[model samples]
Target chain A: MPVKLYIDAVREALWEEMERDSRVLILGEDVGVRGGVFRVTAGLFERFGEARVIDTPLAESAIVGVAVGASAAGLIPVAEIQFADFILPAVNQIISEAAKLRYRSNNDWHCPLVVRAPYGGGVHGALYHSQCLEALFTHVPGLKVVAPATPHDAKGMLKAAIRDPDPVLFFEHKKLYRSVRGEVPEGDYTVPLGQAQTVREGEDVTVITYGMGVHWALAAADQVAAEGIRVHILDLRSLRPLDEQAVVAAARRTGKVLIVHEDHKFCGFGAELAALICEQALFDLDAPIQRLAGPEVPAMPFCPPLERAYLLNADRVAEAMRRLARF
Target chain B: MMEQARHRRPEAQWRGSGGEVHEFHEVHPGEPPRHRALGLDDAQAVEMYRYMLLARLLDERMWLLNRAGKIPFVVSCQGQEAAQAGAGLALDRQHDYLLPYYRDLCLVLLWGHTPRDELLAAFAKAADPNSGGRQMPCHFSDRKLRIFSGSSPVGTQIPHAVGFALAAKMRGEASVSFVSFGEGTSNQGDFHEALNFAGVHKLPVVFFCENNKYAISVPEHKQLACANVADRAAGYGFEGVTVDGTDALAVYQVVKRAVDKARHGGGPTLVEAKVYRLVPHSSDDDDRSYRPREEVEEARRGDPLVRMRAYLTEVGLWDEAAEVDLRQRIASELDEATAFAEQAPYPPEESLYWYVYGEEETSHAG
Candidate 1:
């Protein structure tokens, strides 16, 4: 085991997979000599050379399009969008081209491609940079959306995404890139897609969240535990093709649930989670499903103080947890 | 009989005179340019003419079926048949990958789709292997023939074709990917991106733009400001050639050279075939709203089929008897295809929800 930053965990997974399979290649803007805007692909370009670690043009549609094509031609490509907000230009390629390649061809062809983008707020990123778009892709069929909440999950899920025989949208929380540190396994490993990680156990209430929400919920759970209220935290690592069984079981375990997410409160991912819980385990629950997410503003502001206020954190999660426990 | 003939319009009335056919060189119809010579024998030349003719015939039949409510839609290759026949025949179908646009009826046929395959797709029958009756007609695709499934979204296939070429280059294979699109598609961001990627990587690909002068009633001048679609290829760091698409031999010669260059790792080349939209864009479109009647008449006079037929007759590979035999053969094949596709069963009810995700058994060990 080795302690690694979350971004480093992703980089290590990319490095390990490229070493393991020559067919797995990397492509995106500034991914080669510049080592990516966030340096997630640092040094892999020199190690693998240009063919495997390609520096592509400033065209998101083409990057995804080429990935779809190359995947069909027997190459597993991991394409990156510098920021998740910039992925709108490529939604056509992502939704129409890559996702439907397998289905439209009637099993004749498929796109085993991974699109990695750093998403979320809390770093003073303004309207352009700090936005969560997972819910948009989550609605699409034939596409798998994953948001890893830990270094271990980051390394494991990315490797799994590359190996899966479909297109995957891996949304890496930018705030947790360097802030989160944990022990990551040394050798080849994978956390299967469409699975959930129940990070903490409790008897009173279950805090369901993902990405940065996982960390915030854990801290909220700890503070609440000291006050005599035991809280359970479930990290939904994969959003699309969600772990419904785990979600229902978690809802059944606590009988009271609070869904926390940094995404917008209106029609956010929490909406879907809430719907699933209500649909699956409504009888098991003693209370109505509670959702604590960002206010329905357009996006996060740039000022550090305001950005923190706009984003969800442990303090907000604690308030929500106390309310749920009291209820 | 003479009284019936007298009552007919002067243009329609039969005249007693010596009707003589002229040499191809003598008939300078519709300003056909000097055709570049190809390494094709007389028989091969006849085959080229036949491909263009068959494409036209199939296109006509599709429109008939569509109008009769037997088929849903048709994206015709009527006026661009020369470009389709010549460029498609130029590729090495045995090894090359083809990414044909929706209007490429003849090009897909060169890649080995039978008349029945087209009809079955038009009928959206259960036996239609292109998409298992899922996709619409004219969206040609078949893995067995190396034809990647085409999309209704124009210019999307350009990148996929480039990907195929990249795969060939990495595998150390001599295979080339040939992709086609309408001139209007050149304005798409995907077009620029695909060519840019191919140029940067020096992929073994050839981009063919079937410049049919109109994209469903939007004229080319309004779509692109450049002098020609081929002119835009220079931005992608490749050679560009604008050939007279009416001359099947010239189109064949130009595309043949491009295929050879791509196979030799010379990077991609853009070929713009300046053809006319012989009919409305599709069975659903009405060109009279935008395209002038005089312009349509001019294009009909320079029809690729008429030009190619003249070339075949001049080369002495065709005659009235041969023409009659060829028509009869083509008509019989189409008749058989029509009967088969018409009677083909609809897909099973459960199949409507199939293929949205793969059926591969996932490994639970991960």
Candidate 2:
């Protein structure tokens, strides 16, 4: 299979999942008729029918809540929140009820559902349309949060998420959806959740990142490789049950690390990784872990300079990579 | 006939209508229904007493844990034990389901959750059975007991219960799903949406609101313009009934009827269990900041545990000595739970990656 884009992978995954399981369904605004804002769910309604690919009201709460209800009833509902920023309205359903149902009941019943949203900045999406809120979801227990950077991972992880018997928040980086593509197997396959993918291997310094940050980090690593600094890049596919072991092992190998994330630096998922590495794998490090995050800026801006400054692009990652290599 | 002609279509059927329909269920004019009966025997009564007492003790201990810096937070259901215990006993664990809010510690335990799990969840210990120490205390989940986990947000579970009930109907199963939330949750738009959908679809559900008269600092007066939570049911086109939540027997009888009605395809019912939150909203909250000490003292007068003790005494089912013994036993058990959780290992650094999705080995091994 030739390399495919993330959005195409998502489309193919949904198409394949619906084809494989009659119980799987899609519900969200413009998802059915308008083919979703990003067209990730384009043509789904035509193929799966309206009942399967439902065009829900503009209520995000209802979309998520109804999905919770539908999932509790034994349907595998993949609900799209359109923009990740719009997900706050439905946060209660995802954070409180959908996440805790099985734990509170002591494993009596399980909420087997997936909530999909287009997250992150780039493409000039304003504040509301762009945000890497994986930390918010990861901070919550009883919920599984996954963000894939490649088409193959998207297809594999999404299929696995749909089949899993718990609620999962699947974040598709809006910037990478159409831009990032790779070969995804046509047959049944699943990228295990809570695992990290080593996108590039090196030994001088490790770059730990996820979602869109993976691409930026990879780009930085490639640039740094020209200077003879080997950078080990670990793309965190999942945020909640973060692959700490992979991070620890990589940290141990390089003895230096740079945490890069599109989310603001303060209280970001990168902070969690920093804490874990310090708490358990501190002895293996040669220097303090450096993090080059999007400037602790407010958010995505309408202006090009402001947006560029707010997003953690390849340049920042490259600078951080060089700094860590020196360390 | 003239009155019927003059009256407009009930507002419960649609949004923006003030007729009191909750979420999706409606309350049409009719005789109020009850829950399925729990055939109480001496042994079962004793079990209920133990469960209620243990729940109360656990709530108090958790509150202390929060104060002592052992647990991060606590949401105690002190005065609402009878309602939770009796309603829990009324349901068929195998066929029915419960979607509880954060305050439903007893209901969670009664439905088969262990105290060890609750303690771990409360302490945010890595060994926490609910989410591997991911969620904060009181946020619980399990897949085996047919009980839905709860989030911190109120009123979100209402529609989930409706969906579960709808599934039961679709599956041709004689099952009902009961969702429990506090009185303040009725103010939410989702609450109305869930009730309306339940009533319109005739889904087998019991929407029970533990009317404790407060949403953190806001009292029932500010929470709703309606006279009572049950009164809002009139808008939903189904029978809404208000029961004394402190009275276990009364709550049991009413809930039993509602469950029975649901099981027999009578659709959903809105049952409001009027009660009170004896403790502060949570360990992190201080009731004195907003609630008058006098009001807290007054609310404490009708504690459900005391009422149950009186009821059991009148029926020659309990006495002072029996109460002391039971209290001592429950206290000891809760103490053990706290000690066990404190000593349990924090989630291993590597263990963080476990169980996000069910491990194929575990899912298939079992």
Candidate 3:
């Protein structure tokens, strides 16, 4: 076992998969030479050479579009979108092309593409740089959306996405790239998609969250523990084809649920979680399902205080947890 | 006299003075006929004519079916048959990949799509191999034939074709990826991005543009700022050639050279085949609202089907009896295909949920 940073874990998965499979290749902006903006793809270019580690032009649509095409031609293409906010130019390729390739072609063709994009806010990256786009892709039926919080899940789930037979959107929270470090297995391993992991067990309240929110929830749960509030934390690693059993069971465990995410409160991934709990475990709930999320502003503001206020930190999560527990 | 009658029409009003009719014999007089010099035998030339006629006949039948309420839609290949058939015949059908737009009825047919398959898709039946009644008609795709499936969004297939080319290059195969669209599609971001990528990678791709003067209602003048769609290829670092699309032999010569060049590692070529749209855009469209009736009549006068037949006749490869027999054969084929498709059952409702994701877990080859 090795303790690895979240970004390094992701890089290990790519390196292992590329070594294991010759057909697996990476193409995106700055993925080669410069080793990606976040250095998640560092050292892969020199090891895999230029062909396997392609450095494409600064075109997001072409990045995703070429991946869609390459996947159909028996190549596993991992396309990087530079940033999640820049992925808007490629929405047609993802939603209309990659997501619908299998269904629209009646299984004659399938696009096995992995679109890796760094997402979420809190590093003073305002407007364009910081945005959560998982909710946009989760709405698409044929696309699998995954946001792994820890190094272990990041490594395992990335391997699974590379090997997936369908298209997947892998969202990596930039704030956790270096800040988060956890034990990861040394060799080949895969965490099956569409499953949730209950990292902590408790009884008073259940906090359903994912990505950076998971880390915040864990810290908040620890803070609330001294106040005699046992907070349960369920990290939804896979957003689409969500682990419904885990979500319902977690809600039923404490009869109190709080959905948290970095995305907007309206029509966010949290809304879907709240709705699922209400539908499946309504009778088991003691208090109304609560959601602690970013405000409905256009985006995270640039000002330091406003940015801090816009984000869901441990204090915010702990306050929400205490309120739900008391309720 | 027939050549004068066919070649006398102005190359399209939008083309201005640059759209001169280029005669193959004028370049190499006393050489063999156009198709012979282009490496086509007399029979192959006549076969090309047959495919062009088949496309025209099938398209006419579809229009009738639409007008009679037998089918719901008709996106025609009425005037672009020569370009489609010629480019299709020039490709290595066994190895090459064809990503065709909706108007490529003849191209798909030449690539092994049967008349029944076309009608089945037109009827959106369960046996429609293209999509199993999921997509609209003329969205051609056949796995066995190596034809990539296309969507309604224009120019998306450009990148897909380039991807196929990239695959062929990486796999060390001598396969070329051929894709076709109208001139309007050249303006799409996918088109520019795809071509730019292919140019950078030097991928083996052939971008065939059927410049039929109109994209639905938008004419060539409105669709492009440049003189020819091929001219845009210079920006992407490839050879671009504009040919008379109505001349099947000329189109064959250009596309054959382009396809051969790509297969031999010469990179991509942008070919603009200047044809015309003889009919309105689609069944839902009424051309009279935008285009005048006289222009449609003038375009019909320079129809590719008629030009191909006359060329075959000039070469002594066709006669009145052959023409009559071919029409009879096509009519019967159309009748049988129409009846079969009309009686075919729609896909079962449950199949709607199927194929959203691959049913089987395909193991990754390690």
Q: What docking tier does model 2 reach? A: acceptable
Q: Please give the RMSD of candidate 2 to the true structure.
A: 9.6
lDDT of 2 by residue, B1-366 (tens): 001111112322322222121222212346221111235766666667688888888888888887787777777878888888878877887778878887778888888877788888887776665665776776656656776665666788887887777667766789889998888888887788778767866878998889988899998899888778888877878878887777676677678788999999898888888888887887778888888987776656556676566556645667889988988887888889999988887866765444433443264221
Candidate with top TM-score is 3
lDDT by residue for model 3 over A1-327, one digit each (tens)?
A: 789999999999999999999999999999999999999999999999999899998888888988888889999999999889999999998988999988888888899989999999988899989999888999999999999999999999999999999999999999999999999988999999999999999999999999999999999999999999998999999998799999999999999999999999899998888899888989999999998988988998899999988888999999999999988
DockQ of the two-chain complex in candidate 3: 0.76
Proportion of the native interface contacts kept in model 3: 0.75
Alpha-carbon RMSD to native, per candidate: 6.6, 9.6, 4.0
* Clashing residue pairs in candidate 1 (N, C-alpha, C atoms within 3 angstroms): none
Residue A284: error of model 2 in Å?
6.0
Model 2, A1-20: lDDT tens digits are: 77788899999889999999
Please tell me which predicted candidate would have the highest lDDT against the true structure: 3
Stretch of 10 with least lDDT, candidate 1 chain A: A101-110
**CAPRI tier for the interface of model 3:** medium
TM-score of each: 0.94, 0.67, 0.95
- Once superposed on the true structure, which residue ranges of model 1 sit more than 4 Å away at CA? B1-23, B26-36, B360-366
Which scores higher on lDDT, 1 or 3?
3
Per-candidate DockQ values are: 0.67, 0.27, 0.76
Please give the C-alpha DockQ score of model 1. Answer: 0.67
Q: Give the candidate order by descending lDDT.
A: 3, 1, 2
Clash count per candidate = 0, 60, 0
